[model samples]
Target chain A: MNRRTFLKDAIVVITGAALPAAALEWLDPRQVLAENPQIRWAFLVDTHKCAGCGFCVKACKAENDIPYEASVTRTWIERYVVTQSGELLADSPQGGRDGFTSGSIDLPGGTRVSEEEIIRGFFVPKLCNHCASPPCVQVCPVGATYATPQGVVLVDRQWCIGCGYCIMGCPYGARFFHPVHKSVDKCTLCTHRLTRGDASACVEACPFGARQVGNLHDPNDPVTRAVVSERIGVLRDSYGSRPRVYYLGLSKEVH
Target chain B: MKEYVWRPMYVVVLIAALSLAVRFFLLPHDFGVHEGGYKYGYYRLGNIAEWESRPALFRSADDCGDCHRQSESLSASPHAFISCQNCHGPAAGHPEDPPTLAIDTGRDLCLRCHADLSYPAGGRDAVPGIDPLGHHPFRSCVGCHDPHHPRQEVQP
Candidate 1:
């Protein structure tokens, strides 16, 4: 079936099971979804192989016309360093790859090298975790932020009240409130692109294939099975958000 | 107490109806941008498949000055490529709301990329220090620094 038909069917199946009886007849989610699935997107990150290259971050801004000079990162690269003595330091690269010649990264996934400091190091690309059980959804007062059955969390700018609660609730600190839109924002994992079986900007931009996208329920799906075969670690699994993105061969201390 | 009527809903009816609302109305659907000029920009997106009909979008930083029209001093800095979102966050929804939906994540977004002291624009050009107000308890680096272009002044 075509995408529209599939969406309509999925909506009927899920919403027919979720909404209140009073609101069903007037606003049947099923009928609508029989047209679309709302926001359906998810990601799986492999930490073991990420080069800490800021390519994803750079690429996101470039593709979207995101400004080049600000501290805002729709996506970013992190440097994680672990010492033999068990000291851990995490930082985003200070100047990204463009400024990498200096080798200074003091933020998440940064390098801590000195004459005496013996350590292991690597990088991870960080973006919105896009959780199935998103806390950002619970804290939104106007219901602007909501999750799709497929588990992508999104905000409706028209309804947003400018509250920053979603920013606080995000376990990965991924949300960014912007001035132009004057709305709380984060990576949407390029939800619009997924309409035609496209991957997110970050996933496509990475030269290393460190980022993967797919559904967990579908066993044959690469991301679903990779999490099992590769021993992926969900960032702060303790937050209980059940983030879909998984990092492989990650240093425990990096979390 | 009587306001709390406990009528049971049919299992199938209850599940189907609720699922529809949650699946469609409550969630945020994708609204893609169709702005021109990004054959290679971060926001200049395209199909993910390697062999897709479209090529990736990218742009030169100076192109932004045409519309933003910042003063020559602010617009010409090396941090010119730093788009508005680099400092303010994604603006896709900004036009719908004014100055509010875009809550401040504080200025740390700036410091995350550029440190407090010294940054370059082009060809080894440099601007030093992110200190906004030396007196405020918040570290100058944390607040005054505008990462979009550290060479520029802090937004009030």
Candidate 2:
């Protein structure tokens, strides 16, 4: 064969082989473009019901298979202590996994206070808000993070480059680099659980029924009913992330 | 000289066009997410399938109720809305190979909600003021009230 024919034949074989292999590795375009999505899920957090038991944090770590490390929390509870002087103090030692002491705000090797100094305090649990207009999804360069049809935000671990852009963009400080997977990790809202008609781990773990996950599209859903009837607040509503997690009895002192 | 120069250029163009044809032929059939104005297909295309490979970590409460029907009494009480797993921990391994779940009988668990706070003394919150010291000092609240139906149980 002549040099030109040989070169031409070689290029064709390589291109033919690579195209299908590349296409198989990504999210299906059809699934992404499906119109008229019927599902819209939301998380309702009743801060009033939260007792700072920290069971939800422990449950989350166990369910998600996250390590028992302080820095890599997928969910954590914040005990907000607003003193009579109107000063706010918040902390979660070990994500409150071992639970919290009410009378004295005992942080891990940090601060301690007597009941005399405190006025009122409450616990606010934190996790991926799964924003409608998620900044994390927007910032992900590889399109690894995406919101599902049911409104759950998920990270495609295989596609993630571990750039941490999504982590930085998350206003709730939910996303973290996975120590084991070495991929960008955050709460999936437990999509695997939700899809099967089960509640998220944290929601199920809440002894007080403080946390709930439901489909906002379904009017009859208890969570949807509660969200509509109750005056709900989102974390940093001004940022316009449109967080799906709704909070009831959220103190003004909480951020 | 002209034949030699032009022939190689023609061959290069042919290969480039053939590569484009292969890519177009192999391109995914469905249009993916809509970007600004146009559609961009095949963006992270196989992720959905990949995600489906993992099993669910949490089981539905209904799964627990299927076998442990006695626990359904919680539905009639004030704690009706509370999930069983909330107190028993994740029942991920229940009914098949049951995992030993922790049962929280501690006062701290009960007091997280029952304990009074100065947050304007009840609007919608079911929280009632308790002195803990005066009402039942050094006593577990579960001693008197059932965790499921607090009002139904009488104080001993």
Candidate 3:
């Protein structure tokens, strides 16, 4: 082939290959909205109803494939002991898996106190708040963590680089490194079950009906109604994460 | 154009082309900022499907009520609100290969909620708790109390 013709053909071939790649970038699909736009999931916990049975913790471990013996849990119950002298003691033994059977409250530095000085105590169940403005999502450099339109925050295990930034960013200390998956893991609000019109495993496992999940957009939802009618509060409202989990009868002693 | 200028321009263009090509293949097809816009954050669009595909291990009490007559006995009792799977373990597969599910009859099982820590507030007082040592030391709860009908004694 002539030199001039060969140069022209080479340029054309390169242009042709590069054109498609450039076009594909522009043609990339935009992420779609949630399947049900009207549905926003919210959680409710009745502090008065939680009996500290630890059934929810066990059920969550089983349902989510978290190791039963793992020190971390997707859900856990904390017993708060407020003494007459204004000292606050909080402890969660084995994440309340076996319940609080001890008469003494053990402190972090090995100090222990008998129940005699305690004036009041209560069990508070905690999990991922699935905040509307989740700090975890904000701090995820790789975009592995995100919030669903339904208000549930989820971690994309495959995409997570295991940087642990999201775990540190969380205000409630909700996220944890999975012992097996080696990625930052937390509660998904049982997105698998919720999508199928069933309650989250923890909610269903609560015997006294302490935990509940509901559609915030649906005014008729029992949980929504209770939230509207009851004097409920979220944990650490000052953080402004706009947490979706609401607690009934939340005491001032709780952090 | 000068030869020196042309050579530098060519090198820059080639590197840009190579980088673009690599990114096109490395980026996941389903990764992007979702419906809530940038404030809500970006994630793999397919992760929703991945999460939804996980099998539910725990089932509701209504699922058990469909087969076991003992469920009826529980409804009228104080334990009605509790799911069978709570104490019975996740009902992922049952009454087929295993034929029957194992029941937790340990004293610790019952004492989990009933053991008296004497916490006077925050609804702990609602469920009556007993001093494990003072009440029935080292005895199985089911020996006398019927779990299905917790208020009633087991007939000899």
Measured by lDDT, the strongest candidate is 3
lDDT of 2 by residue, A1-255 (tens): 999999999999988887877576767655764644467889999887777767788778878888876467888888777667877777777777766644566656667765677777678888899888888888877667777656767787877899999888988898999999989888877777776667788887776778888888777898899888989888999998889999998878778
DockQ top scorer = 3
Residues B33-117, candidate 3, lDDT per residue (tens digit)?
8877776658888888899889988775577767777646566888777788877867777756454565788888888788887
**How well does each candidate superpose onto the true structure, as a TM-score?**
0.52, 0.69, 0.87
Task: Summarize candidate 1's per-residue lDDT along A145-249 as a digit string, tens digits.
Answer: 665445656666666778899888887888877667787766766655454465666676554567877766555678877876877787888898878777777
Give me the displacement of residue B59 in model 3, in angstroms.
Answer: 1.5
Model 1 regions more than 4 Å off:
A1-40, A83-86, A94-99, A104-118, B1-156
Tell me which of candidates 1 and 3 scores higher on lDDT.
Answer: 3
Query: What is the per-residue lDDT of model 3 for residues A126-214, given as tens digits with 9 covering 90 to 100?
Result: 99999988988988898899998778899999999999998899999889999999899999999999988899999998888899999
- Give the higher-DockQ candidate: 1 or 3: 3
Model 1, C-alpha of A92: deviation from truth (Å): 0.8
User: What's the lDDT for residue A9 in model 3?
Assistant: 100
Per-prediction fnat values?
0.03, 0.20, 0.69
All candidates' chain B TM-scores are 0.34, 0.56, 0.84
After best superposition, candidate 1 residue A145: deviation in angstroms? Answer: 0.9
What's the CA error at residue A251 for candidate 1, in Å? Answer: 1.5
